[model samples]
Target: MSKGVKTITDAEFETEVLQAEEPVLVYFWASWCGPCQLMSPLVNLAANTYSDRLKVVKMEIDPNPLTVKQYQVEGVPAIRLIQGNNILASAEGVMGKEKLISFLDTHLN
Candidate 1:
């Protein structure tokens, strides 16, 4: 886990994400994915930047298959913005910092 980001597992998904008080930014990644590695920094930045309004969590796809399947996350570097039982927004692949910010602004605001 990086600064401002909490590592979450499949078993903790419900308690940590679905039950969160604020919107949660879920970053789905895997150890062997290059794009996942590339997006880590941007995700970390988002975690810090939106700490007050958002809960940032990282889920490794391998160990968290339950959540991955539940979310229909078919690829690495997937991003999902969820609040309560609703999924507000989602995307796949690596996104740059600016694009990431724009995406958050669109869904979060």
Candidate 2:
């Protein structure tokens, strides 16, 4: 993990995301999306807060088209919570700190 968060790409998806031992939170984003940029710091903050319980991964939709397709991502700033290759919950658009925390609390613990 770099800077306390793991960034997953199409090449690393299967092992780092699908087979992760702990719950995985994939933040699908793109550089062009304003909301995505705004949400990044919150994502990083959540990564720091939930360091022990989850693996927070950022997947750039533009770079990882395959992952976007596989996950059926239709928008930037999409948050997908997964466990053992199964999706537990998902949310589209930017999420605030409290909502992000609530999302993680619901799925991770």
Candidate 3:
């Protein structure tokens, strides 16, 4: 299921996300974050669930400097649903499944 999701790097951030033709859900996390470990499955599920309307991608924050700073991502387990340069919605830390789905559905309609 998560195989459909792409693990992105800062180098590919521009072409893969910022230039994407459709809305993108960018999940920023760190390998050492405990909540991030728990949130991974939820993120992947969201990727598969919203595949038709979203281009879901995950980025490891520890190694990705440019995007971490550019997006003002100050912590792990962060999500930014964006289209082009506009961030349609965003969330930090962890959330419940229903809330997560609700967050993704915000602008997809």
Candidate 4:
């Protein structure tokens, strides 16, 4: 199966996310972050569930410093919902599948 989860970088952030035709769910994470690691599977599940509705993109905080700083992501496992190049809502830390879905719903619809 294709891993719906993708690691986005600074260069691709604009075209791949900000300019996306559909809404975007971005998970800003770090490999060494405990919460981020724990939330990986949940993020993947959300990606699969919402694959048809929104784009689920993962950005490694360490690699995408520019975007990270630009977004002011101060914590790992920060989930940002973006549409039309604007951040509608965001939250940090681990999120279960249900809560994540609800959060997405609040922003997308």
Give the Cα lDDT of each candidate.
Answer: 0.93, 0.87, 0.88, 0.85
Candidate 1: regions farther than 4 A off: 1-3
Question: Which ranges in model 3 have alpha carbons more than 4 Å from their true place?
Answer: 1-3
lDDT tens readout by residue for model 3, 51-94:
87789999999899989898889888999998999999888898
Off by over 4 Å in 2: 1-3
lDDT of 4 by residue, 1-109 (tens): 4339887899999988989898888899988899888889988887887777888899999988998888889999898888876888999988787888789777767
Better of 1 and 3 by TM-score: 1
Cα RMSD for predicted model 4: 1.7
| TM-score, per-candidate, Cα-based | 0.96, 0.93, 0.94, 0.91
lDDT of 1 by residue, 1-109 (tens): 3349999999899999999999999999999999998999999899988887999999999988889999999998999999999999999998898899999999888
Which candidate would rank higher by TM-score, 2 or 4?
2
In model 2, the worst 10-residue window by lDDT is 1-10
Candidate 2 C-alpha lDDT tens digits along 51-98 = 887888998898889989988999888989988869999999977888
lDDT of prediction 4:
0.85
**Candidate that would win on lDDT:** 1
Count of backbone collisions in candidate 3: 0
Highest TM-score, which number? 1
